[model samples]
Target: MAAVWQQVLAVDARYNAYRTSNFPQFRTQYIRRRSQLLRENAKGGFDPLLRRQYLKLRSQLLAQRYGPLSEQSSFRAYSNSIRSSRTTLDRMEDFDDDLRAQGARGHRRSVSRGSYQLQAQMNRATYEDKSPGSVVPTSVAEASRAMAGDTTLSENYAFAGMCHIFDQHVDKEVPKVQFANDDKNRLACCSLDGTVSIFQLVPTPPAVLRVLRGHSRGVTDFAWSISNDVIVTTSLDATMRIWATEDGKCIREIPDPDCSEVLCCTFQPMNNNLTVVGNSRQNVHVMNISTGKKVKGGSSKLTGHVLSLSFDSPGRILWAGDDRGSIFSFIFDMATGKLTKAKRLVVSEGSSITSISARSWISREARDPSLLVNACVNKLLLYRVVDNEGTLQLKRTFEIQQNSSPVHSIFCPLMSFRQGACVVTGSEDMCVYFFDVERATKAIVNKLQGHSAAVLDVSFNCDESLLASSDARGMVIIWRREQK
Candidate 1:
């Protein structure tokens, strides 16, 4: 036993010396050879011992050359090799362990190291690996730790730490608004310069495809119909224009009845041809767009001046938020032209409602139901509609406080089909925050910062593969998940 231990120690010492002296050359040769092998055997065919030796040698060489450029390439190659080796080892060891435990003798004896210790080392190495191609087991805690250690995540968090300075740019105090189409293929942004820019995204390199100029005054709000072909925009000039999305042609201009400033307008998701427009008078009017005529429906006046509105498809409920910090829900009967009261829920004490949006489709209790998410000036509220004796009632309120700046826009999208539910919120503080709603806490999963001005709008694609954000400076940024 003493002689055996001595032989092991001598082998290790000689290996260390060889690594120190010729490791860089060995690593370069090994990488080039392995890359050629990988190309030949596309699935990667490498002996276990050779793979381990390569990994050990590469790690030593990488540690020796520790700098930005050197570390980047070495880490990348090491990560790819480890991932391929892990997969090969896992597949080869699949049924061998069970067979050995069943009293069947294998070709080689079992190693002395404990399984738990080996697993623990693997976990640690996975956590420490920062390369893009690192392979990790599918564990929630491990995935979270890996994400936390990502450099991109750290940079974004640092950027979000900056607080928003209201009136930061008095000269460029132009209010900006942005909205994403139903399909999220395009994003339309309007600024105070009487310019409405439409960005086409789906392609490899996204670019601005069309610029619509019909509003003489600053555009306040706009909504894309469910079809995504027509867009209606309202301005401070008390005029609303409907434009064709393909060519940016103004189809019709709907003048206000009393010349009251059109605060907001949205297309009814359930009724494609009808649109509901709200003004400073706290009244809601439904109009038929095809005929350009009012739908012969009487307007419903809520408590305070209307600020924003959203719809919940599951409950067929329309929520109207007002300046008095109150939110009212009404159910409309299109055939009878009647409106039924659902519930009057108060959101905040002094803060007015700014924006409202519904969480995209979600699967709950094996049924797909849409959730209603609302954003007040200083708070974020979420409520679920429950069926109680055939009446829809707001069930719960999950509140998130904004300490630095007011919550200007809140967007909740199902980021991952495997992960339960996630939401991203952008505030006037020029910061974008990500939260996992299934956790039911304000634990920030990630943050993004690029816009120097206030972030006005945020939306995610249908597949949740990309996130698009627009700020007050007419800048639009699209973020996509880095593929491994």
Candidate 2:
């Protein structure tokens, strides 16, 4: 019995050492390679033989890395070995007690690091199956349909009329509107009036829940945290403020290190404690919101004033677009939050990029990771993310009037099971446009024409029941999807 206990102890020690030294590096490399292969496979351009070759290569790589540590000596196996080798019932109870204590500590660590949410987000992004039942990209829509009924074919074309119009920031020019992550009813928008209004839509007679006001100048952009507990907003005042959603109080005010107007900001999808902010001085920074300090080696200079920023679903890659019409990609270090610049694509000379949205899976029908971009070139561009290094291949372009306004667009939230996916964009033509992405020509699917001014931004709630669009004239229209 003593010998068996000693062996178990030794195994635990070895596993701990391996986890501390090698597991992290191995996991990073393995995920990187897997993501690259997934991108290649999603393109659907490779023949069966080449696909088999890729699969074989992946198997060999896994074997080479995991061969030394077999399943017999894994963490789970160690626990089972302990259970089997217990000499008496008392010893088994003691082992169970030890496991309970260890589990408590693990739970504490998971909470502190917010790892559970991160893991869930990663799983949704990387779900392999694209079936109607599979919830890779549109879990909310699927869940909504499951609760209510399956969406009908005519429902896809039912976004024509407006349900509500918020004119509180009248004539102030609202630049952005966004629905909270994983939420079906709540949404927020920032305006040139220097305030952010959060709205609740569930109850009848939807109204603004709270107005967040602290910025000295026009609020440029804002991002909601993963848990929707707080919001971070950038402003023309050259400061970024974190606001508590519970009471709409300013928790922390962080000034830009360069003392330039902060143009845009986004929460690092995997880490709410970290936010990526773009400034008018041509700098992109990764900020530790908890400490209100910039992460070391996480700052990079762009070719022009950084106008838009986006991250792939996993948060491994960041794409930032500048006023010079160039989009630059950077590799984001998940552990340290460091950024390494990777690739760049020039859309057009002197055309400002107004928005960048990255979607890993546009729909179950279209599995390619795509970037939806709005620039000053009078067109909305769609590009396929081709490689792990953040290279982009232009796939399609939809014409729109986007000559001057800082217009934005988004992938429809409930498009996963639709026969064809759709993208919605705010246009300078004073309209909201939806384009069927799979259509080869005449791709316009639906148009909402209530906004009298150039539409600046668009957002959809998690279930796609409500879409909120903001225009340049400070009008926010909430469009309801007609149920058939």
Candidate 3:
């Protein structure tokens, strides 16, 4: 071991002279040789400086090629928020775009001066006689009373409105009936015989205006436009026809894509040019009345065949009842007449939702929380729409237990001149039943018997002054408030 150590020390002493500063020529030549060797290295190709530059250029190119498009909304907003380095003109354009987006999201219909005047006139006309203790009734009210005759309504019930059949439906099925908005005296009805009957509702007898004939099959339901100039009818023949109500001329017959037999339909809340129809397949579809084109995107389908439905404009929601006793709701687009965001709930086991009445349509309903009434099987359900978000909360139910069997799907909700709340629907027996809507007790208040057969449909005028019903035998009856 001592010999090995001595040999290693002798070899280190031999290189000590080369490592010293005195060998300046040797140090210079050695450095040049090492540099040349490093330049020709086989392992790592680029130096750190060159590698960093390459990486920077590559990243720039990739970003330019695959980055988000500036035209998209989210990207534009984000770029604008971070683009202090961009030109002022560019930033201004982004700001304007954001403003336009906000405007679109919060778009609302404009009210003109003419509309305001019309609204004021309507309010005055509606309240002229009913506001307070006026000695005499409005001429219209008095005329209504004289026309329908009077009966003293029960304490809990409002006017019993007289009941009389205007015309017998040739077909056995009851027709769907509706009174026009601008003129409550104008009643439009759908017949099973592929015809629509227009009648003037006054003077103890309703005179026929015009009979509209276009549907190849029986008509199911129809709606009077807000202007009361047009009537839209959905038929079992898989077409919805628009008619000029004044002359009873068919304007157009819009075809259903599925031809699945439209069971029901109604007009869009704000637009008279839009109509929505529900089919036997439990699907809802929208069409442009002016163009007769099916709306492309917005619509919904339910799990059951839609029998009845109603629209709530402010809530941007629609409710529909189907044959399976299911009520489905969806968010509605007022501008485009489309339906989306659907939810379904089965309310009854087997009964179809026969009728739907929104709160505003009800007489003297609470306006804060929107309300809707559904007549299912033998019961009436009141659902309160929460926060104008189409959320339905069961507020109350009115029913007749046992021995009642099933009632007609018709419900007529009315607010009386005295502010009484009442709802009327048909019973399996040859009678019409009235219940107090504001009460939770659910007792039968009155039963008006006039129809020899099942009363299939009922509607009340703007006021509780009159009630109209249709029976299985195609009899249309008008019931007027009883005189005190």
Candidate 4:
């Protein structure tokens, strides 16, 4: 027994060496390799000894992977789990009740924050008028047919009326407005007036939280970090600025390397530390926001002035549109932040490509990854993502009054519990349009009126409780979802 114990220690020491050498390979093949090592070492009496050593190694590995089983460590992990769950639930309705129920579930809360986030990513099936919508089906089939049987905007969304109109950028064309990724009640918008306005929606009456001002020219675009702690904005002033969200102070200002107007910007979905920026010089550059430097091999040139940028949910694919009416796809290297141009699709010769949005899945039933595009060709285009290379095949087109303005559109954040999919876009005809992508004859599901100028952009809160649209006249309207 003393000799056997010594052999076990020897085997564990060898395993630890292999683990230190190649941690990832050690993790995946530890069981098989460790067993072989144990058998080879104790060839004469390997049965009971093998079982004992295997169990011991597995236990030690688990303890190392997850923290030690001490009471303080366990309590600390539990508190972190609770905090992560709460942050995720903040985007949902009745989160307080959900948090309390999660607390009661106790021992089942041992999963990591990544697991909780994976479980929380689902389609919104229903909602209350006052609260953001709720409930996703437990299974794909159920989620496909959860709410209304069809996917028409008229069937799914009952917009009560405009909840509020913010004219903070008065007389300046409001180019963009977006809700924070995690907080449903917080949003911000940028205007040609060279300022960005942040707004808070809770506490009854919505009001401006803070106004960010620094650009010498019009603010072209902005993006919120995934953690909601920072915002990055581009401007015609030939520079980009990062702002701390808490105090709305500009932290780092980077001038475009090409000394041209920075036209657009977006944070890498999987990594907030890397940002993709487009400039009027027909160049797109991936930037390291932390050190304020352009990443090596992360820059590419387009045929025309780059106008818009979008990344797939995983940040593995990036799509950029240019004023020459071409959309180009690039493979994003997650580790090095390098970009490899993959394919290009030209919709028209002289028209400008204004916006592009990529979705991994349209609905539970129709699991095809799709891209929504807005080009100045009098149409909104939908393309099916046929391969991992981001090659696009035109699936459908909905007629809109798009001509020249940099109009933008977005997929309804919460997919309706229906068979079809929906997309919302602003039109140059002073209206907001929602189209059922599955409908051929009458693709127009609903048209929102009251914008005094060409509608430039549209966005929806995380839960679909509110929809915000901005226009050329600098008006931003917050529309409420009606309760049935």
- Per model, how many backbone clashes are there? 0, 0, 7, 0
Tens-place lDDT per residue, model 2, 1-484, is 2222323333332333334364554432333233333433444555655555654564455446544455323433333323222211122222233335667788433432433333343344332333432223233234223323455324665775888899999999999999987577899999999999999887968899999999999999999876678899999999999999989999999999999999999888767789999999999999998899999999999999999999986688999999999999999998999999999999998999999999732343233578899999999999887778789888889999999899999987544344456789999999999887767888888888999999999998866778999999999999988866
Tens digits of lDDT, candidate 1, 316-412? 5667777666777777675643556667766665456666665443221112132344455444555544432122234334444444332344444
> What overall lDDT goes with each candidate model?
0.51, 0.75, 0.58, 0.74
Sorted on TM-score, highest at the top, how do the candidates line up?
Answer: 4, 2, 3, 1
Best of the two (1, 3) by lDDT: 3
TM-score per candidate:
0.59, 0.71, 0.63, 0.73
Candidate 3, position 479, lDDT? 78
Model 1: worst 10 consecutive residues (lDDT sum): 130-139
User: Which residue pairs in candidate 1 have backbone atoms (N, alpha carbon, C) closer than 3 angstroms, thus clashing?
Assistant: none
Error of 3 at 451 (Å): 0.6
lDDT, candidate 3, 1-484, per-residue tens: 2112222222222222234468644433333233223323412454555544544564355346544323222322322222211112121222233335557899533334323432343233322223232212233332123222332225525455564557746445555777775245768677787888888877656677889998899888898876577889998999999999878899998988677898888777655567788899878887788899888775677778877878763436778877777887777775666678566667776667766665443211123233445445455676665544466667667663212222333334323322234456665566777865544464566777777776666666644556777766777787776645
Ranking by lDDT: 2, 4, 3, 1
Cα distance off (Å), candidate 3, residue 354: 2.2
TM-score of the candidate numbered 3? Answer: 0.63
Worst 10 residues of 4 by lDDT: 125-134
